[model samples]
Target chain A: MRTALRLLGGQRFLVAPLCLLGAVIVFAASAPEFLTLGNVSNVGAQMWVLALLAVGQMFAIVTRGFDISVGAVAALSSTIAAHAVNALGPAGLLAGPLTGLLCGTLTGFLIGFLRLQPIVATLGMMIGVRGLALLVTGDGQVVPLHDADLASWLAFDPAFGLPPADWGAIGCILLAGALLGRAVLGRRLVMLGSNPDAAHLVGIDTARTQLRAYQLCGGFAGLAGVLVLLRAGTGLPTDGAGMELQSIAAALIGGTALSGGVARVFPVVLGAAFIQAVLTGLDLQGVSPFIAQIVVGLVIVAAGFLEFALRRFQGFAFHRRSWT
Target chain B: MTALALPLPVRSAWRRWRPGAAAWTTLGVFLLFAVLVPRFASSGNLVNVLRVAAILCVAACGQAIVLVLGGIEFSFGSSAALASVVGVLAVPWLGPAGGLAAGGAVVIAIGALNGALIAGFGLPPFVVTLGMLMAAAGAAASLVGGQPIDAPPSAAFAWPAAGSVATIPVPILLGAAAVTVLHALLSRSRLGRLWYLAGANPVAARLSGIAVGRVTFLGYLVAGAFCAVTAVVLTSRVGSGQPNLAPNLPFESIAACAIGGIPLAGGEGRAHQVVCGVLVIAMMNNAVVLLNFPIAAQQLVMAVVIIGAVLLQNAGSLPVMLRRALTRRPNA
Candidate 1:
């Protein structure tokens, strides 16, 4: 059971179970409806978009880089996809995600290949890409997809008596786990992230590996954008506005190192779930939307504190060496 | 040394004025806009450019100080937002001057928090400042209840965009004054020496009796002051303290300074370079505005330029320069 928990990975599992169970126990003790399957599934369904973004962000963070442009990229893909739906019918949906993937990959390439600093490079992308998104949408959102079928189905459909989006999110995590744990490219990505200099010395094309990280990340961000659009049935500017910060928080909460090298996909997936669920719970509890952001800020502070504490205890040293 | 042999000081002076390639490229772009775009050459537009660039320059200057001390700060946005929100709110009683003072003080407090966390407690600046960034943003937004507060109706505030002396924008004047003072401080003062010492090698500086932590704290304090001044100027200019005004500010300033030649790894850069960088970005934005490029076009151009600027800044030293020169010499 201990190894199961450990293998399920990192400290991510511990936090979510503890928090979710605590919420359940408290709410159940008080309201009795908190432990219901209906409420739990609702929480999972709602976390779909943010959870996807967290997966993309986890990749960037685990590779020892950061992506502040996810919000912009995601927004661009979602908005563009919606805007193009009028032209391409079902095919138009692909337009936004493709553009999003291109932008994401290019941004990653700029950071990885051009030797530009990750944070600054992504910051530039956040500015330029967001503006580009606004431009593509003519400074307005595509409020309704020309064909909203796929979006509607993704948002409202149920599969095997579970919310489709929630199940889809779980499936995405499983795929990511396979790619990262069992694939050769995944191992190379891990090596490049853990120690680029050493990887280069060992004949690994570190640059290629680095670029692939961004490419893979951007593709996911693009897909996440599509998922968001599908869920919302439209594209909104604010969709990606501050999502990067949340994504970073999600990845960190899931126990991925910010400086990159170690990863536990299941934990990050759960982390994303935790965020969505927590925010949903707060909303249900009658917390105002704006004020609830304080919770996010608090969570981020807590994560930083945890990182600092872990560093102080030298708890990460063992893991750090293994990955490198 | 023989007279024909270039005096080392003279050689170093030449190096200082060598005009970095990025500097020249950006300057060339500026000139092209001035010549090609009539509106860009107008004094009014030029002053407006200065005015806009002044906000960035002020923020970047603060950022440059921290960068110079071998760290980075993202709390500039938060500090500016907090000060802008709270300082102007105080203007009903405190007046415009009070707004400036209050803003400066609040930013300093934020800066002190960042410094204490990073230097005093031995925390990473990225984590400390990132945390402070969120906290400051939240606190400021909450303080103002997420609304805009009108600035004091003081024409005295206009002095930044256009000082009493005809034709100078107060922002430009203030930014210039700051650059001068900071430049002198970096070159002449004991504190500047300590900052340089710490930035160059924290361990060595500590070993040599330099109070590295205090120097870091001082750097952040100065950064806070710089942000405060920008807040005051921006509030005065915009005629209100909009809580979300500094949304892209931290990134803009860091990019400007970085594009100008300041490396995030720290040490071996000057504040003056940041001024040049800020001007380049401001000019680019101004030119785009003058040209009436759509927002998307602007973003694309700006992103490309940013990447180009980063590349130019990171290009190799004299040896590589010589090799390039030789390669070009054959063509010329």
Candidate 2:
């Protein structure tokens, strides 16, 4: 019984998910319309974007690096997509995903090859990409898309009561999970993150592994941006504003260790959903949007504390003994 | 606190001039801007740049101290916001001195809370400060109803920013005074050595009988005091208590420290390096504005410079990091 209780309190099963459920139960009880089908779909739509970003965030976090520039990449990708599609028609659709891929690859190359610290490198990229996005838009105006059919197909057309964006998010998560779990490259990346010195001794290509992880992260962020553009039928320079923080919060809350070498898909996705649901509930209750931002920030710190406490309780000692 | 004086380690004077690259780079960048951009070399623009750089320098001063101790205060920006808001609002009832006290008290209280959590409870500095950032911002918003508070009609309020001593702007003079005190504290005082020792190796420092927790706590306190001081000056300069002010200050301040050759891993940096960094960023901003570059281009250029500076600073270690990854060992 004690063993079963211990197993039940594991990171994968408890902590974040319970907090999420607690929030949901409290909010659903308070707000009558929170559980409505329409509201549920609305929450689902919001969850998909953040969910995608969170999954991408997990990749970077697992490598002990942060990709704050993901938000900027999303903004740049959407703007580039809007311009390309306007100029070349359907071929522009290819521009969105490709832009994301190329941007990710570039970030990976810089971080992996140049040995730039993750936070500093990604911050530089974030600022640069955001600037480029604004430059493309000119005067911070939104880039309106003329491709209505594409927009409808990407965002509005729902099959089996779920939109294509949700499907895309699910697909990305599945693909990422498989990459992290089943692939040889993914295992090497984990080992690289777990102990760079050990991995080096074992002849693991740490730099290349870092490159692949960041590239994948960038790709997801870029794809997320394209989805946003298609849904809104416009590319706003500020689309990715505050998203980097939100994604970081979600990924951390989902239980990805900041020191790297650990991640879980379900927790990350659920973390994103929890955040979205809380925001939705707050909106329904007429709380200020700024308060939501505060809540998100607090949630991150709270989750960190919870992780520390859970680890202490579980007595699962790792290589690094110090919690802080 | 008195035990901080019990430190003696044989060291050369070489570490004092360690951040020479940043200082030299500032000079090089200044010359480039002076030649390329018209009016950039003019005394009027130069003083204006100094005035602006002074504010960032003060904030970065605190950040430099924290970095030297292997911690960070991400909430400095929000701390300034809250201080300015409370300071301004309190001026009408408490007078200028009282208002300043109120602001200082609030910051000190927040600092104590941060110190307790980080030092006593072993919470990570970044997470604690990040939470503080949001909470402070939210408090400021709710307190002031998201509106800018005008400075109280008092001579004390106007004197801080408007007054000058012997042709130097008061802000510049205050900035100089701050730098002098901080530099002395970090280099000449025994407390500074404790910070360096603790940051360099916490376990060793503890083994050497240093109260690492107390030192860490004091570092946060000192950082908070500087940030509070910055808020006071910013409030006086702008002549208002705008809650929205300095939203991006912490990022720029951290970037300044990084460019000044302060390692994020900590245990090495000086007060003068921060000033050098602030000047570099200020010159860049001045150049962009003078050249009439688009806002977008300005941001891009600033980002590029920050990355370039960090890369240059870490250039020595790059080869080692790369070789570690590329090296192949024989069978384990």
Candidate 3:
């Protein structure tokens, strides 16, 4: 048991996977249908939007900052995509991400160049973007897609055992993983986050790194918006009001250090998946959705406690080993 | 000796003039609205604005305390919503006054919980408060099956919101009292000094024999008490329990504090700043409505003002690169 504890505590990214496994076990035992193919596919289909958002949030959090504006930006992108699709056909899908990139750039400018606090900058962006979305949709009305057939096909029709939208999400996640693991910008972001003073001393352009982080975050939010648009078959201006909190919770639970610098794309995705599973499992059990929300909230706090415990145990174990 | 003496008077004069940017902004916004928006200067409309500002002021005062501790409280909005729900539910059994007390206790309890988690565990304030926010909101929602619960209308129930003492609304009186008390606590009390010290530098404060954790815990508790007052008044006014009551309370309060020149980095704020910030926001909202703009326009304007206000406030501290970028000539 001691060795097991040490092994588990030794790995930085293992917490999310462990939590996911525990959730799967408990949910599978309580709700027999949780592990079934149909429900699994349902969760698979539903999780991409959140997954995309969580991954984007990870970028900001890894940089020792976070973007709360992603949800609002996604809504704005969704509305923009709806209008673009109506006017320009299938080519308009690209507009969603482009719009997101623009919003992200503005947010990045505010945080990086203007030196505004991340929370303040993102909060301002959130309000402005929500307003922009409302303006686009005219009084927060949902904008129905003209190409319903295409949307449904992309959203629902399975190719390679997954819908096109899910495939797209997977592709984006892979790209994000590659970017974080391989790219020079990613290294700069991590270095900056770990120690801004040292990064500056090392000649890294800190402002530009922050700018790129927020840009990547916003771009991911835009991709999530595209997914939302495809899934809902409409542009919803007010759809993603609470998603920012969920993404933050997911990123945190996925072992993305709130203190910044440490993170992984796959673990964060598992974290999102765990949340989605809980939500889905509760729904299947006829439990109130609000109860699920409470559980999620508890899980978030529990994740914090778990992190704390692991840190303490690891320290103790190291001390004992060195003394012996 | 003359130069030093001259500088003393100049510094004092600057201090006297320094209600700071937020105060000036309030005056400017009020005057602009009075001139531009028809009927905005009318006494009745002005009273309405004050009435709205009163509730926000009380909440923002609590928010200011938390900000002064270098902590953020996102759960205020949801906790207020939960309080209203719990308050209304208890009214049938506990009566109006008793129900209100129960609701206030619930908020205080939540504040204590947040305080314990943050101070005891060394968890981030953002994480703990956010978690509590979700939990409290869920509790409120689940309690009523996601619907509003009406409290039986009574004179006693409405007294806190509607009743007047000396021809002044209770909310306005309460708002004034909150500001005055906050001012006293921040400037005159020993606990207030400790809060400031802890917020500014926790490690140094600890080394200096201050109980930093206890101070932080109390700051959150005091903030919660302030939010409770606002919740009670709001519930009294609505005469119902709402799951979605004041969802923007946290955001609006933070904005108000920021606009008032209370830096989020903490350890400095004043009661007058909270009042001035609340007044500016209230006036802007009132003016937007009076001007017949779309709801979207109101949000857009608010966003612009919030960002612009912060930007303007921090202009003096802008980086050399940014200052150069701003001043660089097109030809050059």
Candidate 4:
């Protein structure tokens, strides 16, 4: 029991599961329909896009920076994918991730080699990508998929109690986990974020690591874009306007330190799930969507407070242990 | 030694008169627009450009204050929206003047709350402001049912936005006044120095007994006051309360500061820099409209200009690096 307590205390993402549990309990009690299998499945299906985006965001945040251009990049990728699909059949879906890779590469070059501030560089990319999305479709017209039936089948047809898209998202997330946890490049990213001077002294290529992190971030956003296309059966250039904030909120709530160098993929996915649950629960209760937004925002701040409290608690625990 | 000594005074003199990269860029954009776009150089169009820039400039003054304190405010857009909603709602009970005052108070109160949370709890300013942004926007939307509410037309209410004193538009005058006040606060006051010190190095400032927390709180509060002024003017101009009013205010203000060559890393900015940046953006926007470009081209052009302008600010190092590379090749 003491060992378990110690383990829980040491875990950075302890709050994510706790928060998720608390939300579920509160929602299940307040709304009788909250725990229904239909709603559960509905939320599970809906959360994959956010899950992918948040996982991607983890890469950037772990590098002590963030990319605010993900939503715009996703929208742009979706538009490109839509056009490609129309021209080359369903095989054209590859266009989305590729476009995202190209955009990410540009942003990475600016931030890495050119030495621009991450926020500023990403802000520029956000605007430029949004413009590109609009320009391609002739002033923000939605591009409908030619193969809507196939897209819907992949998005909604349940296989092994989960849609193909959800399975794909889970696969992508686990791959991200492996990359972040086991790969040398991931260690370099964390090391650079934790202490740039030390990383440089140890001969880590800080610039290249940052570039790779952003590339991963952009690539994930592209995958999210593709998911969006699959679900909506259309390319929406303006759809992801405020999604950047939501993804950041999810990553933060998942226990990714804003000060950098700490993250876990599973907890971050749980964070995204918590957000979806809140929105879904609030919707079940007939509350306005705006109120849900407010709750989500408050939850983000609460997450920050939780982190602060956890740090204080750990300090107190350390003192107690040392005294004993 | 003689050559170096001779150039010292000349360099100092040049520094004294030399416009910053932002200022020069503003001038160049202005000249380019004047030449390329017909009717852009007309006095009427110039006034229109300034008028449009006026609101952005006022809000950007608030943004500049927060940036100098090494913090960012994402709630300005939403807070302005909330203020407008409250202002219009209070109009039936409170007179127009009172309504406006109430609206200003709402913004100030929100600012004070943000200040208290950040100062008291040691919260990250970004997280706190972003939370406030969401909550405030939700409140605004809920109050008005996500629709715009029009205030009963009144001459007194319109005066703040429409009234001119001796051929000067009120917003322009207000914008200039805001710049002047910011200049005085940043350069002439003790609190301003504290802000700079705290922003540059908080631990050092704290160790020096500077009360960094209080300085930060006051900075955000002052920023709120500036935003309140903007909200009031915007409400008056539109003659209605809009839940989505000025949704881009925060981004635009931050962009203005960036374009003006104010480092986001904090510890340095000037009033003239803000004006120059605002003018550059305003002129670019005006030229885009005047050029009759497709709607999509506007955002594309804006994207290029923002990146290009920021790149230009850092261009001073490029030439030096190039020269170094050239010099080293011969030795190799």
Candidate 5:
């Protein structure tokens, strides 16, 4: 069992799956409706946005970075896209993606080229982008949307029994698997995260690789923004309010190292699903919402402990090496 | 030899202070705001800015120590909220002095717990403190049953925040006192030096026989105490325990420290960084209000400043700077 856990990339990676399984068992026993296919699809649909954000976050984490700004990116993109769609109709399809790309590029430049600390840099961007979002929306009111054909197609249109957004998330997950497991850029990013100095010495342009990682993160954030905006049927600036913490927690629980380098796409998606299940299960069980916050926080901390323990077991003396 | 020797004092002063890019930018912004903005240069407004900056300085000062030791605390704002709750609730039971003391102890204990988890278990400070931020915020919310706890208005209990000491506002005086004590701790105390060394190179510090774990643990304890001080001032000023008090403070405090030129990666920061950074933010916030710009603008500007300050402050040395200088080619 120990060797199996190690082979699956340590006990840390197993946490999200185990949590998901535990929630299923517990919730199925308590809430009879939880086992219903109808509720299962409902939970899956709800988890789509978080899963997308986690996938974006995974890219940054793989390169020894974190993008707290993704939430803001989502907010800004949705708001901006909402405005554009209101004015330009079908042409506004490009708005959300473009806005996300722009925000992602900016965050990329700060961390990759400018060498700013990822957390602080992205944090500043988070606040700044949110401010810009608020400024655009004016008076913090949610921008009401008129039902457009494009919006309906993307948001409400069922794609063989699921919304297009859910399909998008699944596609992104597959894309992430390909990117991290096979693509050269993804491989370079893992290398850079493993040891930036070594990667640089080996003729990799670390800055560009890191920049690409953030750009992808930002793009994914943008996609998430568009999907969420569609579902809500309006551009809510505060929509992504707690998402930054949620995505970070999901990434951590998914087994992405806070210290960076390891990135597995499927586990991250499962982690997001696991968190949603826990929250959904709690809600069904009539638990307080605040408990969800506490649980997310504790899970992240636990992930940290588990990661360190696993690393120690693997004979990686972190303090003696990189930290010092 | 004479000419080189002539610049020695000047060089030494710069090295000793090593005020990062943020300090210069603060001065530039001060001058700019004073010139372009109406009534910005007025004495009354400047004092008001300083007064506001004082509260931020309390938390930022504590955070600087953590940053210097290569850790970050996201819990200060939430901890302050919790402290405010504790202080206001305890005031009726324990009176003013005892209430503040009780509140102070809770905040300090929160910090110590964070320290023990981090230092003892080798857990990442980011995750540990992020968790604490969540738990603390939740606890504060749950304590008042999601309502703000109001303290009965009393002059004696509230004097530490509302009243002045020798013409200075109590909050301002308290802030100044905190800064002074922290400055002394960082510059004059052995523990401060140990913190710097540990932050710079923990393994080296451990090999050198420094108790890196204990020092780190204590550093967090001090940070917690500072958070309590800020909480007391906030609670007393408002005459209430506000669970929502200072929600944005953690980021703002960090931004202030960054503006003061504290490297986010840690190892080198000081009390002055907190002061300078807070002043800049205070001034900028004042500018937004005075200019009739939306509050959102202030956040946007702070965000830009954080990125700009970090970029300029940590861009490596002279030769590297010259290499990237606009008019030059890489191999030229």
Candidate 6:
């Protein structure tokens, strides 16, 4: 009974898995069309951008930092990709993702190397980068990608009849999970998140580890940019607004601690999918996207609260006592 | 108090430097900005910078108080927006001061809601205040009917923005006057010191018989009042109460605080430093605009500076942090 109570009381870092389950159930139960092949693929397609952002946010969140600039970077990447797609046709295929990766990497460098708080550093990036994205694109208009053959092959085509981007996202998830979970680099990254000071005491190079995690995160976001551009046939400067918030929400839900030290990247993917599912369900039910945004905000706050509450009940505080 | 148990250098330095570090950092940032930005040190530009920093300072200084107690007023954004709009809508009926008071009252009521949810019900500050952030934003929208409001022009409202004091912007004067009062409240009053005591360590404060709850309530109340002051300044500056005067305020104010060395971590930091942080940000913005740096380049620079400032500030502690991070046990 004590064990059960304790289990009940603690916030299990299963937010990602649970959110995935909840999203699937809620969408499948409420919207009959949601379970259909086209719709699930649609979900998958929508998730392409979010997944990349999830990886980006995962690194920052795990390090007890935030990269709110992910959204901004996404916009800039999308804008850049849009222009690159127009300029290079099929050959410019790699440009979009590369732009995003570079943007994410550069921003990450500032945060990790300069030691700025993730949120502020990213906030500045968020405001300034978006403007740059707009400036580059000449406005909010998306530059259409003319390479239908390439777009279909790279974005929509499926190796096993699944959307190509879905497979790509899966690849991303696996790669990220392997990097975070199994690699020596991954272990060091986790250690960096756990406690920079303590990691330093034992000769772990905190800065380099952090920089690598950020680099990986940026790369993932870049891939997400490619997927988004391919699917939409165009990229808008506003493509990734508020994406960082969603990614953070998904990561926190997926069971990653906001205070760093523990991470589970696969769970983060599910969390993202779950959140998208819930939003899709709400959209089917005639709820406005704005309302869904509010719902997403609520979910994040709830997830944060749960983590805080669960940690409290177990008599093992992972981080400082936050307003759970 | 735990430090009291320790002898010599540790306790005294903690009491002295920790309290004033934020202020020194703020000054340093201001000086840096004034030197770095072209025309940053110019008298005309300096006044403009001060004017820009003043309204935020009014809001942030109060935020500093609440943060000291570990309570965050995310509601400041919505409340300021709401106050500005409601005051505008009420001006025709209630006169200027009355309109201001009416807006102030609404803010206080909303703050009351926040206080009740947190203190009375024991809801976490994050949840309670986040809820307020949403609810207040919605309320502001409803009050304005999703449209901009046209406020009746009044000197009482305009005094803050008018560059009336012999080339010195009135907003700067207004901000200075407000800061004078806030500084006094924070430094001179027993209540203020007690507030810091409560923030530095709540359990210790409680053990010492301080009314922790009351302090928290008042701290939030003060936050609301300060938000009202900012609302007044902002609305008057635009000569109307635009519902979206500062949708990004919570982020901006917090960033200013972080950059100024008055992070939300609480206890330490001071108002004098807060003004400097605000000036630094304003100057940076002015410089970016003046230099005509492409937005991206400015972003890169801004990002670098922010991260650099934080790293520089904590460089001495890096070695200690590294040691701690390594020794912390892995998930067994």
Using DockQ, give the best candidate's number.
Answer: 5
Off-target runs (Cα >4 Å) in candidate 6 are A1-11, A14-41, A83-113, A131-135, A138-141, A157-161, A312-324, B1-45, B66-75, B82-170, B194-218, B239-243, B287-332
In candidate 2, which residue pairs get closer than 3 Å at backbone N, Cα or C atoms, i.e. clash?
A: none
What would the TM-scores of all predictions be?
0.88, 0.91, 0.94, 0.94, 0.92, 0.78
Extract clashing residue pairs from model 1: A64-A259, A64-A260, B160-B169, B160-B170, B160-B171, B161-B169, B161-B170, B161-B171, B162-B169, B162-B170
- Regions of candidate 1 where Cα sits further than 4 Å from its true position: A1-5, A8-39, A83-97, A315-324, B1-12, B156-167, B200-210, B314-332
I-RMSD for candidate 2 = 3.6
Q: What is the TM-score of chain A alone in each candidate?
A: 0.89, 0.93, 0.94, 0.95, 0.92, 0.88
lDDT of each: 0.74, 0.79, 0.88, 0.85, 0.82, 0.70
Candidate 2 lDDT score at position B270: 87
2 versus 4: better TM-score goes to? 4
Worst 10 residues of 6 chain B by lDDT: B323-332
- Estimate, for each residue in A26-72, the C-alpha lDDT of model 4 and write its tens digit: 99999989999999888889999999999988998888788889999
lDDT of 5 by residue, A208-277 (tens): 7787888898888887888878888788787787787788888888988766688788789888998898
Backbone clashes (count) for model 3: 0
DockQ of each: 0.31, 0.46, 0.40, 0.40, 0.50, 0.18
Model 3 Cα lDDT, one tens digit per residue, B1-332? 77655767878787877757777777877888888899999999999999999999999999998888888889999899999999999998999998988888999999999889878877777788888888999999999999999998999889999999999999999999999999999999999999899887777898999999999999999999999999999999998999999888988898888888888777888889999889988888888898888988888888887777777776676667486435533322
Clash count for candidate 2 is: 0
lDDT tens per residue, model 2, B161-233: 7778888888888778778878997999988889899888788898999999999898888888777777777
The digit string of per-residue lDDT tens for model 6 on A1-324 reads 667534433346455566677777777887788789877777777876787788767876677666767777766676677677678665565676677667666666666555555556667777767777767776566767766677767776777877766786788778888888788888887787777888778877666566666666666666776677777777767677557667877777777775576777767777888878877778877865656755775676566566656756767732354412
Better of 2 and 3 by TM-score: 3
Residue-by-residue lDDT tens digits, candidate 5, B263-326:
7666888777788888888998888889987768877886876777666666565345334332
- The C-alpha interface RMSD of every prediction is 7.8, 3.6, 6.7, 7.0, 4.1, 5.7
For candidate 6, lDDT tens digit of each residue in B98-165? 88777778777777767665655444565566556655665676666667878777788677667478
Worst 10 residues of 1 chain B by lDDT: B323-332
